[model samples]
Target: MLCIYNLQLTQTHHFFHSKKGVPFADYQGICNWLTRLVQIENGKQLTCNRNFIAPLCELCCASSLQIGSLMHAFDSVKSALRVLEESVALNCEEETTKSCIQYLEAVPWDDSEEEEIVKVASRLGPIAMPIVARISPVDLTATRNVFLSALRFATSSPGGEGSGLPFGDELRTSAQEQIEYMLGEDEETPLVTADDEVRSVARAGLAQIFSSFQTIISCSLSETTETEALHIVSDLVWMCNVLPKMDMMKDFVVRWTEASIVEIIEDNRFESIVWGLKVKVIEVTVKVLEAVGYGTVILQPTLRVQLLRTWLPYIRKLKPILDAKAEQDPSFGHRMDEDLCQNIEGAIVSLILALPSNDQGEILAGWMSGEQVKFPDLSEAFEVWCYRTKSAKRRLVEGGLDRVGNGNGRIETTEMRDMTMIPSAMVLIADTDRKESLAVKGSRK
Candidate 1:
């Protein structure tokens, strides 16, 4: 039976790779053939032998398959996964799940194999996670490792040179576009077309994979040390930063805010965390706030207040280090310190801008009046807020709202004039960075 199966598999491989070049007809044919083989292997007559399963597993593990073949290959693997899931349910066969995991684990993790790995994980993860969860701890850990590895593979940079690809930003934008399109409601077309249905399914599947990835990250954080947890927290924040765009995953934001963000902000060990880690956390937090603003997701007022309270101290702590570094080396390297300060201020500005207008005033007042406020970034932020408020007030005046009462029987001019007219600190920061880059390049030349 094993020899016959191998021969058939080889023949199928040849059929798909023929010079005719994978006709559309071959997709269903391959799927049916693989489905039938799985049925026979899982049938009562075959005694559910492990040897019979090895050939089928090998077929799934054939990562060398071309793109034309991968579609059918993944379909077949999905079928095999179903068969294993059924066997585990009916016969209590833990070995079947283990074997499936082992085959998935064997998939290569280099550039050549990335797309296949992504396809497999995106398909198999949702199916495999449930079964893996029910099995032993060893199996769970093994499966988690494989899933995390595949996730890192999928999201990481293609050539593996830098931090992971900006998948979070891409996925967030895609989700936002989809949501906007769906919400437009401009048409009431009768029947949903096949393409629309397929896209809907795809979105749902992607959401599931995202949730699984979050769970894996959260679980990893629970088991790791503080340093490891910091790394995981960075990933968590990165993921959370993008998640707000997907309305379906709003719960993730709540989970992150309550579980991780609060702890990181409130923890007394803030002084002990290294500078790089601190930067990562702050950057990701800023990203999360920006995502919130773009999506217009309304965070709880208390949470907003807590974010400001916690971030202020960190920004204060960061300033001395940055100032000290500038004093020590006021050269090209000082550009980095300036950049960090700019980023920290950018985050503060974003956070403040995300607040309601009334709340923004309160937050700005506290920051500008605080005795501990030593960073120039705070003043920069204050200037940006003043400029924005001035813009808003000007718009109101142009719109003829100047005559409107403040609901307190007084004009609003007194409040608007008190705000200063400084240039946008963000644009100034950008121009400075550009000039610095050009100067550095010229010096090097």
Candidate 2:
């Protein structure tokens, strides 16, 4: 019995001595050691001991670390989160996961370190979010709070000065790349399992981030100067372009349209903003409409009419600028013109097609008469409308329908020809008007 006791004592001493010899006193050493702990096959068993727990808690409490060290520390924290998630998934170790969460929650975040905080969040969010999403009932509130705090730091104007320039483009690019990697593209398989719980939690987290983003933009628009507002709007547009591409974020389209499009249109100050800012706003607006137009959600009739009223004037105002730029640099400017025109026309046509046939006819008639509405070029819009109508008719015919349209039976070939001829005539009229206007301007010049 004495010999057995001695052996046990020696083994315990050797184990602790080895662990104590590790330089957890230094941040880099702590990170390295924690990374190693994360890689261990039995991660839960390793993390349960005070040797690992105490040092992590100590590191979290440290307030004197520089920004560079904080970033490295966050990397280690991310690794630790991965380990905790894997351990819980493999062994249902709720206690270990809880302890890890508490340590992570203790980490102090300083608002003064905005850029560094953003860097850490952008890197850590992608990794930790997936794990938090997948793990079962592990109380990730503390972890999620950390992520939200980081995002708020990232999106807000630096130092509460309201400069509207959140950070450099590189940080935005890095955050976007990380989010893309986490969410994956529409065609690609998701990085996590398709479990309903996982998707639910992930969506909830994203919704929080988006809500925070909306709040930031609202505050910026109301409180900031024109230059600052431009900064905010530019960054918001970049985010809108990125977030809508995630396959799981279908609702982002509606939320973005409601927040940005509706708000911008209603803002009385919109017309007074700089012309360059107006163009950026229009670009983002068309992008939202195009993305959501492809989806099943139909815009309300009132909103559709409002959008037409708002965009038609903007398009007319933009035509001269586009024309001059295209004349100066045909390649780049024409490409921009074509892309913007296609997006706007496609979106408007989609909205028109969603309306009942009677409403569609009314809208078309209004455009043709230039009575209630006047657009820069109705030709492209009419072309898209004709093509969509033809496709619908073809599908009906292929399905063996003898007639199309509500209450009008047996549509004849002559009616189809008339449908095509009317738009062609309108196109000719529009072309004539445009040529005459250009000639008048040229003579004056």
Candidate 3:
């Protein structure tokens, strides 16, 4: 009774006209009073006026109503939480959301209180998603089952409205959101906490996705039926979107050509589905190359050479064809994504840069060789390689990478010729036979 009478003394509602908004100084007082209302030991809290929610929300945007201060009592916590949720920004710019997450993370559940929260969650929607997302883990089989369902919808062949059937864009939107959240690329924290665990979960999901790929390839081999060939290509590409971000998948990309269907890549004369699948292949190749190429996963010079050699010709040939098709018909689904092309160029440039100057020249000689297909425009890689070769020894001496510190307290200079991890952005002149190759590399175009 004393708490109710005291809170009523404060003119909490009149201070905000809904036009000028609540005065900033009044924020602390309102929060304090609300806490008192919830904290009252007498059951008067059950009957407190619920009318002030709107003006209260206005102040909540900048309120000092801490999450910890309310958790002691369910009535108090729920009352404060209702106001806090009204205030929390989706971008997490508000202090209330942060404190709430930390409190929920640290404290054990008030199951009865959370039942009310879960009810609030059902009505308020994704704004309440963070609590459910963070609180607990679902069954592994349940997780994999939903993933597989999304995988199926995603992998189904591109066709009419009837083909997509019950859930079209909504399923895709959910899958993409789920993927981003699982990968920790979402605005909220990753559903999985540890990086290793995230990767392990990701790899398990990738394996399930890729296992379907193996099935598709094996079944598609002899006849190349539409059902076999095209049905799962989208699934492969869908999973490819995940590949570049995984550090362990470098070997998968390096050894890719063995499992790859050469006919689809080699023969561009195929029908639209096959052509689309071809573009899908290039997309996957570009992603994996990025995984290994951009210093994400290190490879020996020989592996780097192999990676470039395997995919170079296919990309060189496919590049112009994709552009010409898109130019010829704007509606073509197999058209080149400008971003994918940019990644291809960038990934190739990094791989080329990692090699010896002579290998770079030889590899680049293959580029722009055919006048008809000068699509990738390797001039960036060529120019950077040339500049680095000329400045090799000087930059090596300057950066002190020319010699290595050994356990025996010795500095090694001559063995530095094999150093592959050159800092090309600043002073990346790999001493790996750069001196010997320059004369030979210089003589060529």
lDDT of 3 at 103: 45
lDDT to native, each model: 0.47, 0.48, 0.57
Model 2 clash tally, residue pairs? 0
Error of 1 at 163 (Å): 23
As for TM-score, the candidate ahead, 2 or 3, is 3
Worst 10 residues of 3 by lDDT: 14-23
Candidate 1 backbone overlaps, count: 0
lDDT of 3 by residue, 1-445 (tens): 6555435433443333232332344445655656555555555445444455333544343343334443332234455455546545223335555555444434545778777766766776765677666455676556555654554444334342335557765565467557645555543233322245545555565555555565555443434554545545555565656544444465455446445555434643453345666777777778767766666666667776877787887777776777778789888767667788888887877778776667788888777576644467677677667666577668767878656654444343645535654324212443343444555668885
lDDT agreement of model 1 with the native: 0.47
lDDT tens digits, residue span 191-252, model 1: 22123442344344344544443443334223234454454444455445333433433444
Top-TM-score candidate index: 3
How does model 1 score by TM-score?
0.37
Inter-residue clash pairs, candidate 2: none
**Prediction 3 TM-score vs. true:** 0.52
TM-score each candidate: 0.37, 0.41, 0.52
Deviating ranges (above 4 Å) for candidate 2:
1-173, 185-224, 248-250, 259-272, 296-313, 317-338, 371-445
